[model samples]
Target: MPVTHATGIGPVPTAAPKLAPNVLDLFSLKGKVASVTGASSGIGKEVAIAYAQAGADVALWYNGNPKAVETAAMLEKEYGVRAKAYKCPITDSAAVEATTAQIVKDFGRLDVQVVNAGVAWEAGPMIDVEGHDEWKKVIDIDLNGAYYAAKAAGRVFKSQGTGSLIFTASMSGHIVNIPQMQACYNAAKAGLLHLSRSLAVEWAGFARSNTVSPGYMITEISNFAPKDTKQKWQQLIPLGREGNPRELVGAYLYFASDASTYTTGADLIVDGGYCAP
Candidate 1:
């Protein structure tokens, strides 16, 4: 039988003073299984390696880059962790679901999932974006792709009673970038920011959802911009330079491990003070 309350209001309870016995251990991902999309190169690749270094078996997903196969082997050899690569298109909802299920099957369980697959906006501003194909392609991969990944992993998380979902948003989500007109990219990222927050509430008590918004990084993705444009970005950044992919490992690792057990609906901006001023 259910206990009945004498009054509609209940007394407020005092907050518990709980802390980890070993704070450093909180950052360890030992024995956990993680998956990262867009692991073929750039930030995703670095994040995959970092998770393995932290002792988590990882599944790296790449859309077209065959290099991830070798990278997966490298991760296993270097970190002594289980790592594999899957060729799947994030834009395909069914494919994302199938890939995620395979990872859980192969690894026994899924602990962390990083939905980092994305594409750059090749068109100009929204006015000059030309066709709907341009915008559709961006949204399909960046926004919709994230949604599909979350939906697939959320099921596993709910079943396990605990999990972590991390998305690679961008500082562009927070601010309109200069020297380049990527309205579609910014909009998709901004949508992702809110998507993560919404999932956090919806999945509360079962899993945590968060995003890592990186600033201008010195990755191959930025190779398209000219030297003068790159120099302009350096001047705008308070740190006087673009960030390295390695610098973002800590943020991803924290969100992927026990260190952020109580952290959710949060957006960690790893932009070298770009959004500060």
Candidate 2:
């Protein structure tokens, strides 16, 4: 008889199954299908490409950028893998659920879901901002949006008995940034850290949950910061520079692949030593 967890899910294996002898093979996502939100550009785009190169069929989800469609076409052609783009506004829970289900239907199965869609909080300090609109928007997309994706994907994972959920959290989740007042963004990301960990336990019998907290990177999301503000950021970072989006793809890939089968409820920080000090 199989054991059941508190969530009423069946038992997970007690021992590791026979895996490929070659270490590299453990990282291969061949025969897997992944969906990535915010895949129009920046880190999301890079991760989509990395997934394709690693042999996973990819569904690129974008809300405002049509470039994802072209990128999907390129991936399908160059990597000889199935790729497609979907217009998914993660802020809408119903839409997120529908899109996730569609991806499973389209790809035949959903193996990994990356909740990467988010916007930077631009309105200055909370006290100075007019009304609560900005705060709510950030919370809706950054925190609530992730929950929508996780809930939808978690259902699929439970049904399939296996899946990986990776959230694109930020260093703001772990440490408060100096010289910038983005309490909303920080709060949202911090919430994500706990949310992922909570789900890691709740869904342990069927899936894994983890977060990737990236520091200041050269992405459009940070374009709002002025030159001097960024300079201050570099000074604070021990590496004296911002990270490239490509540099963070490995962490996302690891969490999405067989290489991290035993890992869950973890946050991998790629912050160029900023949080180190």
lDDT, model 2: 0.94
> Tens digit of lDDT per residue, candidate 2, span 19-92?
78888998999999999999999999999999999999999999989999999999999999999999988899
Residue-wise lDDT of candidate 1 within 1-277, one digit each (tens)?
Answer: 1122467453332233254689888888898999999999999999999999889999999988988999999989999999999999999999999999999999999999999999888677789756699899999999999999999999999899778999999999999998889999999999999999989877876788999999999887778788998899989999999999999999999999888877889999999999999
Weakest lDDT window of 10 consecutive positions for candidate 2: 1-10
Worst ten in a row by lDDT for model 1: 10-19
Q: What is the lDDT of residue 258 in candidate 2?
A: 91
In angstroms, how far off is 8's CA in candidate 1? 12
Q: In model 1, which regions exceed 4 Å deviation?
A: 1-20
In angstroms, how far off is 29's CA in candidate 2?
A: 0.7
- lDDT score, candidate 1, position 26: 84
Clash number for candidate 1:
0
